[model samples]
Target: MARIELSGIQKRWGKVVGVRDVDIEIADEEFVVFLGPSGCGKTTTMRMIAGLEEPTEGEVIMDGEVMNDIDARDRDVAMVFQGYALYPNMTIYENIRFPLRMREVPKGEQDALVRRAAEMTELTDYLDRKPSALSGGQRQRAALARAIVRQPQVFLMDEPLSNLDAKLRQAMRVQIKHIQRQLKVTTVYVTHDQIEAMTLADRIVIMEGGAIQQIGTPDDIYNDPANTFVAGFIGSPPMNLVEGAIDAGTFTAQGIEVTGLPAALSGNVVLGFRPEDCTVGGNTPHLKGSVFGVEPTGDLTYLTIKVGGQQIEVKADRAFRAELDTEITVTFDPARICLFDAKSGERLR
Candidate 1:
C-alpha cells in the first residue's frame, strides 16, 4: 500500500520560486515520472518527496500518513542518484550490504541478501572488485543492487541512467523496468529524457518553468498534448506549428492555407500537426512548401519544408525521395491536428 500523494506542494528560494503548487495522486505500485528540461524544478519536486528538501507549503503523504516532517533517513524510501553515489574504496559486496548493516539486519542474514541483490543486477561476479575496476555501467548496476537490498516501499530514481552511454542506457532501462515490475514498488523517476519517461512511466507529469503543464500517459502526451509547449517539446522532431489566422472558416498565412475550420473558431491562432500525421505530395494538401532539407534515418526519411517561412518536419517513407528545394504538398489527418490560442499557447479546443 505505497500509494503517494502530493498536495499543494511548492518550493521557493527567497522570492524566486522553484516549483509551483503541485497536486498529484500516485496509485500504489504505480510508476510516475517527472519530466522537464533543466531548472524546471523536476528535481526539486522529487527531493520534496524524498524528504530532502522541505516544501514551502503543503504536505508529502505516503500511504495515508503525512511525511512532511519525517527525517529522510527514517522515511524508508530508497533513492538512486545519477552519479551512482557509490563508495569508491568499498567493494561492491560491501556497498550493497551497507544499507542492511545500517538498519542492523542480522549478520547471519546479510551475506545471502547481498548475493541475491548482486545476482539480480548481474554484478555477482564483480562483487569483490572495487568501484575503480568496474566500467560505468557496472558501477551503476552496483548502485542499483545497493538500492535493491533495502526493500523500500518506494523507489526514487533521479536520472539514474543519465551517466551511461546510449547503448548502456538502453540496456539499463530494460533492466530497471524488469526489476520494478518484479518488485511492484511505487516509483517516482525524474528525467529530462522524454523517451525514458515514455517508455517507463505509467503516467508522466510534464513541468515547465516550475509549474506542471500536463499529466497523462505517453499516448496522451504524444497524441493529445495540452498546449503548444508540450506539442513542441515531446517528439524527436516535434509537431509543426504555424502562426496564422482563421476567418470565415479559412485559415490563411503566407505560403500556407487550410480550410474546414469550425465557423465559431475565428481569431489569431497557431495551427499544429505532428510530422508523422502528415502525408506528403497530396493534390488537395493543407500545406505547401519547398523542401529545405532531407534526413535519411534508415527506417524513415525526415523531410524539412519551408511553410510560412517556418521550417516544418515531415516523416516520409524511407524510400520516399524528394529533391532539395523542390515543392511538396502535405495533408494532415483532421482528427490529429491541433490548435492553440496565440496569446496563451493553450489548446483552443
Candidate 2:
C-alpha cells in the first residue's frame, strides 16, 4: 500500500547541485528504476528518498502523508547496497535475523521469518555457512534475504548485481525481479546498466547531469526517444544519427540521400534510425557504403558501414559475412526514421 511520490525534489551541495527538480509518482508495488551514467544523480535521488540525504527543496510523500521530516528508520524502507555488506563472522541465518532482533520481533517468530526469507532466496541450505565461505552471488542472496526478512514498505536497491560476473549478474537479475514481484513491495532500484533497467523496471526514469531526460516504459523509451541524448544512450549499438539538410521532401547528407520526408521541414535536421531497423541487401537500397567492421556475438552480427564521413552499425544475421572494403547496399523503413531539431536536439515530430 506504499505509493511513493517525490514532488519537485532538489538536492544541492553548496554551489553544486546533486539533483534538480525530480518529480516522480511510484505506484504501489511498482518496480521503478533510476537509470543513467555515473555522476548523473540517480543514486543521489535514491538517497534523498531514503532520508540518508536531505533534499534542498520539495517534499517526499508516501501514501498520502509528507515524510520529509521523518527519520530514516521510521520510514519503513529497506535498502540493499551495491556491496553485499554481509557480516564476516555471522552465519547466513544470523545475519538475516539481525534486523528482526533490532526491531524486537518475538524470538519464536524470528526463526520462521528468517527461514521464509532464506527459502525465497534459495539460500535455505546455506544458512549455517559463514559469509567468508559463500560465493559472490550467494553472499548477495544473503543480503537480499536480510532485506526481505524485515518486510519493509519499500525496497531500495542500489546496483545490487554489480559485483557479480556477467553470467551471475544475469541470474541475479532474474531472481531480484522475481522476488520483487512476489513481495509486491514498492521498489526503487538504481543502476547505470540499461539492460537491467529495461528488464526490471515497470517504468524507467533516465537521468543525465542531475536532471531527468525522460521517463517511460521500456518500449516507449526504446522505440520513441524524446531527444538526441536518449536516442544515443538507450540502444546497444545506439541509433544512427546523421547531420543533414531537408529540402523539398528529400534529405541529403554527405554521401546518403533519403526522399519522401515531410516537405514542411526544410533546413538542417538530424536523422536517426536504430541499428536493428536497418536492412542489408534489400530490394530497394537507399544507401551504398563499404563495410568497415563486422562483430559476431554468437546470436547476431553487428555490421559497421562507412558512408561518406559517418559510420553506422547495422544488425544482421549471425551467419552474415562480409569482407572489409566491400560495398554493400543498406535500406530501412521510412516510418522508422526519426527527425530531430539539429540545434536543440529535440524530436522534430
User: Considering every candidate listed, which one attains the maximal TM-score?
Assistant: 1
RMSD of 1: 1.1
Q: TM-scores across all candidates? A: 0.98, 0.96
Q: How does residue 68 of candidate 2 score in lDDT?
A: 90
Task: Report the Cα lDDT for residue 271, model 2.
Answer: 92
lDDT of 2 by residue, 1-349 (tens): 4999999999998999999999999999999999999999999999888889889999999998999999887888888889988888899999999989988999989999999999999999999999999999999999999999989999999999999999999999999999999999999999999999999999999999999999999899999999998899888988999999999988888766789989999889999999998888887677789999999999999999999888989998889999999999889889999998999988987
List, residue by residue over 45-154, the lDDT tens digit for candidate 1. Answer: 99999999999998999989999999898888888998999998899999999999989999999999999999999998999999899999999999999988878988
Model 2: lDDT of residue 199: 96
The Cα error of candidate 1 at residue 262, in Å, is: 2.6
TM-score of 2: 0.96
lDDT of each: 0.92, 0.92
